[model samples]
Every structure is written in C-alpha cells, then in structure tokens.
Target: MSGTAHKADVRSGGQPGSVAVISSHVARGAVGNRAAVFAIETLGHPVIAVPTVLLPWHPGHGPATRIVHDNRQFAGFMADLAHGPFAGEIDAVLSGYLGDADQAAAIAASVAALRSVRPDLVYACDPVIGDESGLYVSGQVARAIAGTLVPVADLATPNRFELAWLSGRVLEDNEAIIDAARALGPPAVLVTSAFAAQPGMTGNLLVLRETAHLAEHAAFDRAPNGTGDLTAALFLAHLVNGRGHLEALRRATASVHDVLANTRARGADELTLAADAALLSEPVSDIDVRSVGRRSEDITIGG
Candidate 1:
C-alpha cells in the first residue's frame, strides 16, 4: 500500500535488449529490485526480474519481516533461468543485495551460464554490502560477493564503505578510492558516495582501466535508500545500449540528482521514482562531470 506503482511513458514497445536483475524485493519501498527494475524498464530494456529476498520495506525505515528462500530452492530457480525456455533472452545481468551468502556462487554460476550463450553478456555487479555506518550483511555474504561476483563482473558499483572493506584499506581520498577500485577486479568500477573535490558535495566516481571520472552533485542529509540501486541500473543500461563509459556515468549521476531533488521537494522518505520515472530516460543535466587527476587525461565534457 505504500510503495510506488505508477507507470512511465516508455518506448513504443519493450526494447530489443533484455536484462536479468537479481536483488531484494521490498513490497513497500523503492529499493533493490523495485528501484532497479523500474529504471531499467523505463529505459526500454525488458527485464528478467528475479528477487533474492522478500521484505516489507527497507530496514532503514524500521523492522520488517524478511523471507529468504531455502538455498536449494533458490539455486534451482536460478538454474531454471539459466537453462529455461527463455534463457537466451538475457542480454545482461545486474546483481544487488544478497539474502543468503550461498546466493553469490549461484548467481556467479548463472552469469557464467548466460555468458556461454551470449559471449558478450554484460554483467554489472552492485556489491550491496555496507554503508558509512558499516556492514549490513554478514561477513560471509560480503566475502562471497567480493570473491564470486566482483571478479566476474564487467562493471561493479560499490559504496565507499563496501569498497573499503573489499580492499581492506581506509579510502580517505579520491586517489585511494581510485587505487582500491583498480584492485577491485572489475575493469570498470563505479564507486557511489565517493569523496568529492569540493566541500559539501557528494560524488560518484567511475574508475576505468585507463581513466576515472567523478560526477558531483549537492549532498543532502537523510537522502533516500534507492539512489545507489538506481545508479547501478541506469549506468548498466546506458552501457548496454552502446554509450561510452564517461557518457553513461554522467547521465546516470545526473538522473539520480534530478530524482533526489524531486524526492526532497515532495518530502518523501523513499525516492519518489514513480512520479519521476521519465527523468531516468531524459534527465535534466546541470551536473559537472570532470575527469579526475592529471591534466593530460582530462577531457572536456561539452554539452
């Protein structure tokens, strides 16, 4: 009764590409599958939606009942997706919050299985392990994701805390963040809640093999839960649709800022994504996405 249920004016029909989203499903908040699925679908990519866990709402909102399926049952379900009738439909995979530690290995296996059919299958792993406060998931789950998912992913989106835990270092500055992201195994890593160059600003840092870009927007206190989820989904969708790395990072960061501003205006605890779904596809860009470090590597992102 409390979650978003409105629709966006999408493309004429579902687009050609299909993405498999594996994450949590909250019946009453815009987090995990709820946020990612909407952003991806609005961008015109049909989604093979899969829920890793069921919950009433985000834990930040308060206590809610959690329902994690049996490992064997969950494994069989993923196996079905990999070899099922529509197995070939998945063009990409976006993985997020894990309910069980074993789910990581299963998801890795499925990603591998899907890749066999489509060699260029784009897999973006959002390591939903922790936040500034600390690890929300068990140590085992965090390790599993760092080992099984991040290593095999084409891209990874991890918050600063999660990256710190994964790298076993204190990422006190942008240089350290970039260094840790390089060692994070994924060729492209998008670190959310990254340290910004300017004061009172938050940034999303995209650390690529040869380059890095940081897109900063005004940071707000008590922002919604789904920003990271939405960022990962949008960034991956743009890349799958053939946009370059910097372009995708800029667009995704700008869109998230747009929605965050709108949500704040409405005084909503959760992101008002339903009311701003169209913004995901055509975001109003007032963001400054700049190349990080070294003037030689700096490229102007002209309008």
Candidate 2:
C-alpha cells in the first residue's frame, strides 16, 4: 500500500482523458494495478497509478511479501494527490484490492476531495474482496469497502459472489442480481461472472435503472485472475471516451474475453496483457449483448 509515483507515459496521447487508478501492484503478474494501468494506457489514456499494496506476484501463484504503508502516511499521500496541481487532469478514479481497512477511508477522502472541485468526477469501485470460495480479506476491510467506498461510487464492478455479499442476499439468477444491483446505490452496476442463459457461456451484466444488458461470451475454464480489474479499467476508459453504457460493456467484455482466451492458449497463469496490448484497443472477440426486461421476480433465462 506504499505510495510510489510512476510517471505516466507521454506517448499515451491522452485522447480521451487521464484516470487515477488506486489498486494493488504486483511486480510480475497482470493483476491489480498491473492490469488496470496497462489496459488504460494501452487504450490511449494517461494513468496515475497509486499502489495500495506491493507484492512479488499474485498470492494465488505462491507466497510473496506484502507491503502496506503506514495508515497516516497513506492518508497524507492520498490527500496530496487529491489537492495536487494535476488533480484536475484526472477524469476518473478506479479503485481495487485495498491493502487494509483504513485505506478505504483514505480512498474515500481522495474521492471526496476530487469531487468537491469536479462535481462530475467518475469513480468506479471494484470490490475485490473475494470470489466463490469466500471473502479473502478481513471482515473489517470488507465492511470498510461496503460502507465507505461503495457509497460514493458512480459505478461498481462486482462479481456475482461480491454482489451477493454486498447486498446480503442470495443471487441465484439474473433477476436476483438485477434487483441487488439496482439497490446497490451506484447509478450503474456491472456484475461479472453473472448467470448466463446458455450453458458454457458466461456474461457481464450491466444493470441500469430502466434496463439490464448482458454481454455473453464463451466461458474459459481456469481463467486467470484480474479479469474483474481489467473490466473496470476498460469500462471506465470507454465511458470517459464518450461511449454509452451498452457499448462500453460490450467492448470491455470482449477485450477481457480476448485476453483470457489468449492467456489460456499460451498456458500462462496471468493475463498476457502486455503482449496482447492490441486486444485492449481493438478486441476481436464477438460479444452478444441483449436487453432484459426489468422484473419483479426471476428474469426469464432466455428470450
């Protein structure tokens, strides 16, 4: 969680805008900041990367040293950025994988400070708490994220398990997910690992007030980690570039699918994001997006 400033590449061209990404940093793996920063930069956006934690690689790969900064120092560091001269250059903030519960408050402070000057600032929170196995972080960290960061998020990217955990309900189907997402407080919610109508297919569900769109693609077994992180970054990038919600969802999903497929084909444990940078800019994978009618009960699985 230490604050180390990495200079943004001038080659990005900054066509859309700059994004401030707060997340974990792995030295070798394409997860957390490693995934988000590269994806955003590859898509032609300047990125200010704030690492919440530093690790040798994703813990799933093996044991690695984890470094978290002092809470007071982390707070000051975030405040510095919030009030810094370049703060106005940022168009959005995307956060993922907090190192500690206190870091959540620091992030919230940064978000608040930025929003004070730029009322329309976009903040995307990806609750990287856990997966189907259960919560990987302590209850305090989970609560901090749910109570602090999520409340201020303009958009939230939570997988099915996370959405269920955050909403405190069982989401056995898309209808349940949609209900929970609508009530999740964010204007838009992107639920990954969402239920799909057809077997062997997985979808990223984008739920808005009046409608829900499911972007489905072939599910890859043993997909690498950081797909959620990558999704949030790409989605935010597209939106900042003026793409609508549906288009952003489709493009993000397609890019993630393409990256995962490439990772699987290469037999790599992590997403080959660096090698496959073109996928982020122009994903070749086809994603089928369909509108689902709002429901009071269970949503129909198929049209």
Candidate 3:
C-alpha cells in the first residue's frame, strides 16, 4: 500500500465541516482528487478520502499520470476509519467514481451506517455511471446507486447521462432534465455534461424544488475527465457551508468554467490550479442569490 499526504493550512474559527470522499486514489495525478482536496480546503473542511484502488495514473482518455505504489488496501482502510474517527464528525459524504457495483453497494451501506449515527449527515452522491455514450459502472452498482443511495441522498450531482440512467428519463432538453431531477427526489440535482437543444453546446444544470437554472459556458473543445468530480466537490462544500442549492450551483458552475478557461489559457490538458484556485472561494462574481434564475439574459436551451 502506498499513499502521499499533502496538507494545507485550513482557516481557523470557521465551521470545521467534515467531508468523507469515497472515490479512487490515483497516486500520481487525478484532477478529481486534487479538485476535491482544493475545494474542501477552501471551504475550511476536513476530508477523509476512501479510495477504490491506488493506481499509478487515472485510466481514461486524458493525460498520463504517474503511479507510485499500489494501495488497493486503502478502500478497507478508509472504511475502517469511517467506523471510528469518521463518526459524528462527518457533516457530509461525497462519492465519485467507484470501481464496480459492489463498491457502490458498500458505499451505500456505509453511508447508511453513518446516517444512523448522525441523522443529519448529508450524503452528496455523484453516481459516476455512464456518460453520453453508455454506462460505466457495473449494472448492479448503477442499480444500487439509483435505488438505494439516491433515494436517501440530500444532494446529488449526476451528469446528464447518469441522470437519464437513474431516472429512466430521456433528457432531451432543459425542461426534461429538470423533470428528471425532480423524479429522483433529491432536493437538488447538479447535472453536468448537460446538452441543450442547441447542436453543439454543453453545460451544467442545477434543478431545485422551485427553480431550474442552467449555467452554460461555451463547451470546451475537449472533455476533461475529472470535471464532474470537481463540480461535485465544490457544490457539496458550498451546500454544507449553508449555501442553498441554486447559489451553490451558480458558484460551482462559475468555478468550473473559470478552471477550464485557465486550463486552456495555459495550454494544459488538466486544470490550472494557480489561476483556478483564485475562483474557488468566490465561484460566481455576479449573481442575485435572492432569485433562482439566470441573470445574464442567456437563452434557455430547453424550457
């Protein structure tokens, strides 16, 4: 088993919100893990990471990352810690890409246990299933997340594809996506990789009980692998910090868009932390928090 710990100075006196991230740990590089750490740290939150497997690099259609020692044992290690130190301290649990359905079930069961201890603990589950093409998680895992985890989640961030899978809804436009989100029964649903009726534009949608707001940045020519992870991390952090779903969505959307912009400006394949981190604390520069509607007079894709 191999791992590395990089610590940052978290602000003192702020509410010490605790978050448990159940996702994979790639020893060398993973934008998702890094984004999760950065987002949580910015929010002055402590995090316990439960990894699926310790790998050298994140295996996907992205940049090559180095692999150190394998820490496949870390998953159980995290689970054990969850039973102990991660008891009442956990204010929120954020889950990302799981290796398989069994892992999803295990995560769901663990979440249930945590909830047993702290009934108010928020579970922000990002059902990392398939994307525009098809399903990525095992069928059993997909089913477990949709059936078990989602119904109990306080907040969920599912990409457009995952939303369709979880709700059995065909999201052709913004209206359909919002309806699908409502069907899932979560108070809030952050849908990434959202495509509107437009021919070639992709963005994110934040659907709440009363409002459905769409935040569209010009779709980057390339797809960044850990984007959803980053979005989920910040959104959860904001929500845990007392920001409502719509506010959190605006902030998260702006933060991710700024990160992508910085990444492109630097000609980097991955996010540019130096420039992007500045936006972490203040995700959206302008927004009317009172109203849950787009302020920029942008065209609604599917209403």
Best candidate, TM-score-wise? 1
TM-score of each: 0.93, 0.92, 0.80
lDDT tens digits by residue: candidate 1, 83-141: 88777767789999999999998999999998888777788999999898989999999
- After superposing candidate 3, which stretches have Cα over 4 Å from the reference? 1-15, 61-79, 195-201, 284-303
Give the distance in Å from residue 238's predicted Cα in candidate 2 to where it truly belongs. 0.4
A best-first ranking of the candidates according to their lDDT comes to 1, 2, 3
Per-residue lDDT tens digits of candidate 3, residues 1-303?
001111222235654757888776765554556668767877778887766545566666445553322333443654575588647778778887665555655676677888788777788888888787788657886887787778877778998889988888888877788788878887878888775435565667777676666666657887556788888998888777776555666687778777777777878756665566768877544432222233323323310
For candidate 2, the 10 contiguous residues with the lowest summed lDDT are 1-10
- Which pairs of residues clash in candidate 2, taking residues 3 or more apart in a chain or in different chains? 1-52, 1-53
Q: What lDDT score is found at residue 222 in candidate 1?
A: 90
**Local accuracy of candidate 2 as per-residue lDDT tens digits, 161-235:** 999999999998999999999899988889999988899999899888777888898898878889999999998
Model 3: lowest-lDDT 10 consecutive positions: 1-10
TM-score of candidate 3 to 2 decimals? 0.80
**Each candidate's lDDT (Cα)?**
0.87, 0.86, 0.69
